[model samples]
Target: MSLHEVHKSHRVGWLRAAVLGANDGIVSTASLIIGVAAAGAAKDNILLAGVAGLVAGAMSMAAGEYVSVSSQSDTERADLAIEKKSLEENIEFEIDELTQIYEERGLEPNLAKEVAKQLMAYDALGAHARDEIGISQTAGARPVQAALYSAGTFTIGAALPLVVAWAIPGDHLIKTVAASSLVFLALLGGLAARAGGASIAIGAIRVTFWGALAMALTAGVGRAFGVVA
Candidate 1:
């Protein structure tokens, strides 16, 4: 039997980022719409807020993820460049370093050196990058890709609350938005948990709890401010 299972997908991190962005988009935007609407804003006004929220949130996620990931990409590029230069200038030194590294991991000195020499002969920079610098070609960051992914997922998440807003009549808007938002959060949580091989029930419960708190707090604030206004 397997001691433990790790889903080794290169795309898992991307999926995780997308899911996190979507979850934030849904919970925050829904709360915003509910709060503004509960303040007795007109239907058109509510729709306007929701639409603006969706667009702004999507763009924000895209830009933020892009900038952040771009920094990481830049650092990675620099590191790879340095590694390549070192490999070209001091090939023997790098080989010896890799051998020493393997030896330190409890392998016999001669065997470790042999393994290192073989691996380095095939792909010198790749071996050092993976073992020493802890970066892999398979998991390099992509700024534009991350940006698009975050934006797309955020829009998808934003649409859920927008639908609830449209489908419910004026009188039942509050009830509908509250109930539907929780359901949406739950589904998203479950799907994300499944993907990460975690407990769906825990994920669903945690997401819904936070979503409910956000909605309730917003409702309270809206009603309070509505009275004051």
Candidate 2:
């Protein structure tokens, strides 16, 4: 019989970006709409604000993810370059380092040394990158991928509340937007948690909590300013 195992670690990079983008999209757009509505803004103005927020938030998420992940990618390249040079100049030292690393992870000294030699012989830089520097192809940063994932997810997330605000009419716009947005946030959290193999309830609660807080604070500020004006 053959055995198959599944792991979620490989999803770390894109998953993080997707979840963050979607969560921010829903929260920010919804909150902005709610705040503007609370301040006695007209329906047209509220919808316009929501549209503006969606565009701005999506672009911000893309740019932010790209810049941050690019930095990570740069650092990784630098580390790999340095490791490559060290391997060329100090091949023996590299092997000994790999051997010691394996030994620390519970291999016998001789066996570790032999395994290190075999691996280095096959792919010296690869061996050092994986075992010595803790960077692997599976989890290496990809700036373009991160940027796309974040921007795409953010647009989708932001569109949900924006659509709700557009569809509903006056007198109940604020309540409807707030309620629908919270539900959207909870759903997003649960989906993200399930995708990442985490507790659905916990994920849903955390996102909704922060989202609710953001909307509440924004609404209060808008209401106060509306009263003052």
Candidate 3:
């Protein structure tokens, strides 16, 4: 029989993108809807704004993730190229470097060299990439995956307030969305923290606080402008 073990580090890539996308989608869209509704916008106009926000935010998240991750991927490729050239030109030096890395990690000198030799024999490029260049196959960047995750998550998060707005009457839209969005945000925070192996309470409180601040600031601005104008 074979057994498999899962670790939280494996979720680092997509989880981060997902959580960020969902958080932004919920907070930004909800804040926008609440602000516009508070400013006495018509029901149709408010819904239109929410729809527009959802589309724009999703695309923005995708593009941002793609560009950022692509940059990181590019740097990783460049470093790999450098490391590869170094290995090809001077195998001894590369082995020596690997030996030193293992030594620093607390292995004895002769054992470190032997272990490095065995690892190199198994997969020279992989060992060098993992230890010297700090790039691992598990942590490799995938721009497409990141972009898709972010965009999809953003759409899901942004839809919550929109759904609430559509279901409720105009007179109650602002309050309904405010309450519902806060609850939604708290839930998202807790879920994200749990997935990332973090404290649920801290995550929930942190996201809820920021979400409240964003909505409050936007609402204040809308109310002030509505009254003044």
How many clashes show up per model? 0, 0, 0
Question: What TM-score does structure 1 among the candidates reach?
Answer: 0.90
What ranking emerges by lDDT with the best candidate at the front?
3, 2, 1
lDDT, candidate 2, equals 0.93
**Model 3 — which ten-residue stretch has the worst lDDT?**
220-229
- Per-residue lDDT tens digits of candidate 2, residues 65-90? 99999999999999999999998899
Q: What's the C-alpha lDDT at position 35 in model 2?
A: 89
For each candidate in the order shown, give its overall lDDT on alpha carbons. Answer: 0.87, 0.93, 0.93
* Highest-scoring model, lDDT: 3
> Model 2: runs farther than 4 Å from truth?
227-229
Q: TM-score of predicted model 2?
A: 0.96
Over 1-229, each residue of candidate 3 has an lDDT whose tens digit, in order, gives 5597657888889998999999999999999998998888888988999999999999999999999999999999999899889888999999999999999999999999999999999989999999988898778999999999999999999999999999999989988998999999999999989998899999999999999999999999889887435
TM-score of each: 0.90, 0.96, 0.95
Q: Evaluate candidate 2 by giving its C-alpha RMSD to the native, one decimal.
A: 1.4
User: What local lDDT does model 1 show for residue 35?
Assistant: 90
